[model samples]
Target: MEVLGHRGSRVPGPENTVEAVDAALRAGADGVEIDVRRSADGDLVCVHDARLSRPAGRAIVRQPTEALRARGIPLLDEILDVWAGRGRLICEIKNQPGQPDFDAPRERTARALAERLRARGWTGPRPTVADLDAGAGGITVSSFDWFAIEAL
Candidate 1:
C-alpha cells in the first residue's frame, strides 16, 4: 500500500519539477511518478508536455536542455540526484507517436533511459521492498509506446 504521488503532488511546486518531488517526499509520499522526455541536445528532461505552450510556445524537442532549464524544466539527472536513495521513482517515458519527440522503431528514448539507469548502478534484477528500505531505492520505467517498453 505504498502511496505514490502523481507528478510529485503538483501542489508544492510545478508538476515534474525537482521541487515538487522533494515536497512530495517531505509530505510523506512513499514515491513519485514523473514524466521524462528528451531535449534537442539529447539530455533527458522532466516535462509532461511535448511543447512549452505557456512560456515558450515551442516544441520541447526543438529546445536544448539549457533553454528548457531556463524555463524551469528540471533535468532527469537533477531529479535523480535530489531523490537518490530516498524513495521509489516511476519515470513515464513520453514517446507517443503523435508527440513532437516521438521515436519509432529506433526507440532512442528507451535506449537512452536504459543507459542512464545502468550508469546509475541499476543493474540485475529489480530491487525488492527490503532493498528499497535499505536505501537502494526503486525505479520503474513505463511508456505508452509499446516499442519503447520492448526496447528497454
Candidate 2:
C-alpha cells in the first residue's frame, strides 16, 4: 500500500508548507496530501483554514495571494514544485459553505484547479507511468463540495 502523508506530515513542520512536504518525503512517504484554497485574487494557495489565526486572524479568501505568501503561507504551485514527479499529490479543495470564497453554482475554485492542471499539461483521467517519467506528477483532486468535484 502507498503511504501518503496527511498535510505533509505536520509533525515535522507547519501543515501545508513546503517544509512539511519535504520532511514527509524524506521520511519515506509515498505521497503527500494538501489543502487548497482560492485567494482573493483567484490564485490557488495551500492552506487548511478559511481564517488564519497565525496571520492575525485574517480571512484567507479576503487576503491576496502575495500577502498570504509573504506571511509564510506557501502557494499551491510551490507545494506542487516540491512534490510533483517525486510521488503522488492529493490536493483537497476547500470550498465549503459559510467559508469565504465559496462559489455556489459557478464552481470557480474547481474550474480554476482544472485550468491550472491543464496548464501543467494534465489531460487524462489519471497520469500514466510514462507521464510520470516525463515529469508530470500523479495527482488526485478531491473536495467535500460535491459541486466542485462535479465541475472538475
| Predicted model with the maximum TM-score | 1
Best candidate according to lDDT: 1
Task: Point out where model 2 deviates above 4 Å.
Answer: 54-56, 127-137
Q: Model 2: per-residue lDDT, tens digit, 36-65?
A: 998989999998999988647788988988
- Candidate 2, residue 39: Cα displacement in angstroms equals 0.7
TM-score of 2: 0.88
What shift in Å separates residue 138 of candidate 1 from its native position after superposition?
0.9
Question: Least accurate stretch of 10 residues (summed lDDT) in model 1?
Answer: 128-137
lDDT of 1 at 132: 74
Cα deviation of 2, candidate 2, in Å: 2.1
